[model samples]
Target: MTSFNTIIIQNIVESLNVGLMVISHEGKIIFLNKAAGAILDLDCEQHLGFGWGELFITDEKSNAQFNQVILDVISQQKVGLKHIASYTLKDSTCPKKLSITSSYLTEDDATLGMVFLFEDITEIFNAEEREKKILSRNAALQKERIEGLDSLSQAVAHQVLNPVTVIGGMANIISRKLPEGDPLIHDVQVISEEALKLEGLVAAVHSYCDIPKPIPVVVSAKALFEEANKSANEILDRIGECIEMKLDCTVDKITVGKKLFHTAIVELLLNASNFTMEKITDVSVKVSRSENIITIKIADHGMGIEKHLLPHVLDPFFSTKAKGVGMGLSRVKKIVFEHQGTLQIESPGSGKGTTVTIELPCPDLSCCSKKNSD
Candidate 1:
């Protein structure tokens, strides 16, 4: 071919979206297109004239299989079409899926080299994997919800109510009969406290089961924070503990269930108050929009959770505190989920502080308008 034609062909190959590579029968890489360099995560300019094995070989055994496929195509002098291979880069810990195609470069019955074409299919593979996981998770959640309802019902009926009532009544009668300063008075008080604890547990269970469906409305973000602040402050005042909650929100307005959102914030505030008894707590709130999602982040510089305990923090009845019923965060998560939002809790180890984030979709206003009209 003429030099100009060769240059034109090279430019065309370079401009192609799919990765292209040419290796001589001697196992030397003669040409590496830009796309190929990017997909394989290599410097194309330096790799020319280098052995193909130098780039493809890795500690990961998957590369060996990939190399074997290339060898098979060359030995059989056949086209390898749509060969899906797993490739692990030298510096990356994750393996990537690549769709590869190979064909021999021949001239008049003489095979000179081979051309390999490939593209990174990692994102496509990952998306399918994610869908599978979500489907499996939905099935598990369905089973869990049924079992949980049955268990909660049995406990409330047969185990908790009757026993708690008898223990509390007997403890009160015994306390009334005991004289002042009697040592038995302390024992009676202990029984009363235990009974109260059980009663509180029952109330928590009822609250968890009774969360109503949210009615979403577009409301001012500032107004929601103000209302939650007022309610939280009142509870703080009754308890005689003064903790300051400072909020910095950039959001103007959002579409959410007003009452449910308030509950979620207050629950977080109360939980934060537990750690900030000795120090002032800073509650940082920020709202930002990305694509069709709006994210609200609430962060506090209080005693954060430990790494190992973070995973179970959302589990119902799981508590890190001695007297905690562990339903507070659970209720908050339920409220967020019902609103079609996701709740995430992250901490920078113990004592470093924690951040809880809520992400909700930014609904098209026209849809809301149509709903209102109907």
Candidate 2:
């Protein structure tokens, strides 16, 4: 009577939250709790003796897989298996993901039947996917914001630079005429120097935003040297120091933009000058070609970048200088990337100086870069 009277035991399990079912070796369901009946939408009182195929609905492929899994369990092919079933309603609405676990039951070393449990895991999976999409969207928005700021900065810098130049040139003229050791001469010189730094900051803003479409023409090593020297001369005169250009070019007459290439070299020279630790710094420009790639390397004996800060030097608006806008290296990086080239920055420990290298496809081996319509 105790074995046959399972009403009390079944009632206890039926009160629980999770769904549970026990099936015979013939795939016939012997008992199911209230939760299982609700999950499968079955009337446990009327469907207790029904086979799984009659109690549940599924497509042909899934039905076959389900029957095979039950066969494997009965034959002891595996101790347990798990399957996720997605149920679609008549209205085509899908709810939480359902996880079903199937395992065998035994008593006294004899197979009794199989037990199955089900749970919903939809909330957890959907939350994780939503988080990933939010992160991707945030990154895209940040990029757009920075581009907008760059456009605004370029407009403002142009308006400010012209008057700053006039102020600097006037100060230079006054300093040149003043007799040596004049009391006011030193003040004027200081004004001239600060103006020059301001001018550099403005130029950096312009460069950072002004990515040109290159108009390539045949350019020689000597021509590059001259442009760099001329650009650096303004600051050199202000600092009352000089550095020589050490050039070693193996290939001459490489095709590149005359103005843009010169501008990049000059920017490197000015960057070197800004970091000089000595009263005088030595700078060198080296050119070499390997196979179809040409390399231009500029090395300077100046205060080297700190180990930690080197990686961020090319990032827009990231700078060590108190008054700097941090656009110079970013501009150089943009120009190199547009030319299908690579830029590298290398530094020994602080105070040991640094080297900047740029590599581009050799125009002699390849054709000249296509000129932009602009």
Candidate 1 lDDT over 327-347, as tens digits, reads 899989888877777899999
Worst 10-residue stretch by lDDT in candidate 2?
Answer: 365-374
lDDT per residue for candidate 2 within 13-57, as digits (tens), equals 878777888898777899888887777566878999888766554
Cα error of candidate 2 at position 180, Å: 33
- Point to the candidate with the largest TM-score: 1
Q: Give the poorly placed runs of model 1, Cα more than 4 Å off.
A: 1-158, 178-183, 240-246, 365-374
Q: TM-score each candidate.
A: 0.61, 0.46
* Residue 329 in model 2: lDDT: 83
- Against the unseen true structure, what C-alpha lDDT does each candidate score? 0.83, 0.76
